[model samples]
Target: MARADHWSDTEIALTVADYMKMFTLELAGQRYNKSAHRRALLKLLNGRSDAAVELKHQNISAVLRDLNCFWIPGYKPRSNYQEALATYVEDWINSHSDFDRVSQAAVKQPAFVPTGVEFSTLLVETPKPSTTIQEEHPPYSPNRAASKRDYVAQEARNSALGSAGELLILEYEEYRLRSAGERTLANRIEHVAQSKGDGLGYDILSFETSGQERFIEVKTTAFAKETPFYASRNEVSFSADFQDQFHIYRLFEFRKSPKLFSLAGAISDHCQMDPVNFICRLR
Candidate 1:
């Protein structure tokens, strides 16, 4: 029998979207430091009487005014926040969401365009292993939650990175190498491992610029700005035993914000990992 906690990809996406939209309408500015964005949305929703640009006025005041008091969960609202409200009214929609509605809503929402400000910047993380942890950890559970669509989407993001994301990662690698006085450029690297090895193909295997050899396995994630990826047992062992030539690079928040970190040397010498869910997620 399936567990109650299990969620389909569509279910997760829709739920997340519902939270996101409500988050936007009620407290996006309060929850996130989206100052300029908050102001822009207000302007868009509220038309002013200006001589130069003539525009028709759309009164969303009633809807916006009512939703203003709604609060987003999991965040403390800013004390003196200048909040923005939602446009249009949906009698049926509430705080919950379903995938079909979210897909349609996403099309109408203007794309998130970053301003020149640091808050609006796109960030990326290369990959790394870290030791510091701050809070109580949750009981480990295998992701039997990901539906086929979700699995395919997340897997695609982790691998290949759709050329554009790959290009950004390479660019960061080149810049870092140059800074370290290392000249092996990123473009020269290639994936030589056969797909579906004993299990999954090696993340990446390549030679260094100085005729040195490197066997690198990459794990890219966008979990949280501060969280390290959950390393699998196989990953820990592979890097540890093959320390002489192996490397694990972790890239986090590759799209909105990016950070890179790596672990080298015999894995056991540098890190330790738990067994429960580690081996199952090996890829």
Candidate 2:
């Protein structure tokens, strides 16, 4: 195959299959070497270079992101993928009978406090939105039954996962206060969502080093950093109402090694808000 030629259907299918295998292993917590996988995959491709294979894997990550599914952590999504790649990815998902079951199990799995966490590097910069020109409609579209299995949304509703993330942040906040020699403030930190209720829009009530109240909301995902999260209209409004006080502590890859990025001030300023739910009353 010429270097400039578009990937053949066979090549795309093989590549997508290889990517899915690695993704499944990562989700299942099984040990797998990416280098080894890439070496093996390269043998099957038509003289594709290592760099080409790497970019293709990143393209698969982009496709998975659009599908609202978990992707390999090592491969940061590259949005400049060919439309045919998206079609091949959707074909793989549709043909695999166990894809939904395996993914759902991974997303819905309960989480616990990860040990030996490096808090120093836990806080990362929030991801900037992609500037790529998206198509009028995405090329990959899941069938009706498959569309019902929205893994990202399902993960958002996982109370166990959400609680585990909140507890992690709660401890981090206390640590932050105590490390700054504010023991009294650390003691005053409250898991208000647990003590009070979930309607408060924020999960934990913490404090700034200057002794101001800091309201925190936690969103957790078992996937890569760029995975989109759901927020309530109430939460958005509350963040806008108390922009200085509100913070979003996003924890990702919680089932494995956990790391987080925080978005402060109004949530809308940090994220592009979308309305995903509705209320209906008899008129």
Highest TM-score against the true fold, candidate: 2
Superposed Cα deviation of residue 141, candidate 2 (Å): 4.0
lDDT of 2 by residue, 89-152 (tens): 8778878867877888888888887877877788887788667666545446655454556788
Give the per-residue Cα lDDT of candidate 2 at 151: 86
User: Which candidate tops lDDT?
Assistant: 2
Scored by lDDT, model 1 comes in at: 0.38
Q: List candidate 2 segments past 4 Å from native.
A: 129-140
TM-score of 2: 0.92
lDDT of 1 by residue, 113-225 (tens): 22232321233342344433631333222222111112212323333443333344445445545655576554455543433352222355555656566666655543223
RMSD versus native structure for model 1: 14.6
